[model samples]
Target chain A: MTEELNARDKEEVRQEESTHPGRSYRPDVDIFETAESLVLRADVPGVDESSVSVRLDDGVLSLEGRVSVQDYENLTPVATEYPIGNYLRRFQLSNDLDPEGIAARVTDGVLEVTFPKSAQAKPRQVQVTAG
Target chain B: MTRFRFASPFDSAGRLLTLQREVERASGNPFDAEQSPSGRGVFPSTNVFRDDDGLTLRMEVPGVSPADISVEARENTLTVSGERTIQIPEGTSYHRRERGAGRFARALQLPRDVDPTNVTATCKNGILTVRVAKSENAKPRQITVQAA
Candidate 1:
């Protein structure tokens, strides 16, 4: 059962070619919407803070991560189950989300991006006056 | 028996040992192939690397806390077990859920017996690296020759 579960979620890099050389994988992300913001968490193993870049441009959120090649230097693999590569993914954000309010940080190779909803986009209680 | 043991300055036994080590490394140690076979896309995909001195086992375990990970090396087997928990806050709706969360344990049989006391493991940037040194007998030795 564990093997089945793991086999299903293991995502392979698509054939879409990038301008850059080498391989790039689409990171697995969990996106959830809270009352105030939409949170996105992506798994990007082998990348540190300096190598990860998150950008919000023209309502498009882009994530790029580069794995440190020095880690594998001078080491020959006897057996390899996973391919080492960089990570790239993009998402189109809705206008309701404030681009300036987006906050992102990476810890333990997991990148967390929080997009706060615009003030007008949020649900609010309307005051009623007795006529 | 003497001829078999000392066929030449370099005996067949040493060559056989080198060949065996090469085959074991290339084929991922068939002696324990049934245990945690690779290429099936298992969780925390592991890769074994070799150098002159020892072997290095690396596993991708992003988002797993160091406290939750446990690594054990005994004899010629290495066991790595860990738990991954995803905390979903209350009153939240998931738009897309792709990440998996659970506990996983994988055991791998090394090609050669390793020095258990020399094993060292470290988790960095969600990647776990374990270094296992080959035992004294397993490491290649250089013998000195003297004139009679």
Candidate 2:
């Protein structure tokens, strides 16, 4: 059997202070590039569409998600392997992407963000003439 | 009297599978599981919670459809199995691929037998929760003292 992939616990974020009262984890993410845009997908279980936030400022993209702690309010843990927490992570975006054209959505607890490439960054076809 | 008997994250079968994977890695297998910076473990890591009524099992299965997952309870064992698929458009080039895909099944031994008919499951925002009610015969009972 192949080894299964496990979720990683993100260490404390020392750079910024969080307004939320719980731990902030770095959600697992996959990034890829298509012809028109750069796509990113992150696993943020427990977070719905309204609880997720995506912002780009000064070439840095930030992702944050808050999980509803109310779900486990009265339940006591019998055997625990993974902890519940909010999600936080950031990425540096190159100038080739157009910040205004970015689009994001959340489904099945996976957040997908598509950053469209700037007009100048797209490939241009040059006309070849007979010499 | 022991009130609870908790099962460790890795049961006998789980340990054996881990050992086999380790041996394969030592033998220079190319399809080696992607060694994440945080290392590897079972998929859809699970958490078990208990209350007066029953036990609840929660698993993280982002991007997985509810129809793809299955839960079964037999005797005192609870088994969760499912497949996760990630779709990528054609001609896409990956810069970072950390999410792993495929079929995963985990069997967990419960502290007591559960009523098969009383079990229920639900999925929301990629989290799957299975609630198994304790068997009628196993539930805790209170005995009242009669006036002497």
Model 1 whole-model lDDT (C-alpha atoms): 0.75
Model 2 misplaced stretches (Cα beyond 4 Å): A1-15, B1-40, B140-148
Tell me the docking grade of candidate 1: acceptable
Candidate 1 local lDDT, B93-121, one digit each (tens): 99999888888877777765567668899
Give each prediction's DockQ, rounded to 2 decimals: 0.24, 0.28
- Share of reference contacts kept by candidate 2: 0.58
| lDDT digits (tens) for residues A1-131 of candidate 2 | 54444545435455766665545678888999988899999989999999899999999999998876557756666556566677898999889999999999999999999999998998879899999
- Evaluated on chain B only, what are the TM-scores of all the candidate structures, in order? 0.70, 0.65
Candidate 1 Cα outliers beyond 4 Å, as residue runs = A1-19, B1-39
Please give the range of 10 consecutive residues that has the lowest summed lDDT in model 2 chain A: A2-11
Give candidate 2's error at residue A12 in angstroms. 4.9
Q: Against the hidden reference, what TM-scores do the models get? A: 0.82, 0.79
Distance from true position, residue A4, model 1, in Å? Answer: 9.6
Interface RMSD of each: 10.0, 12.2
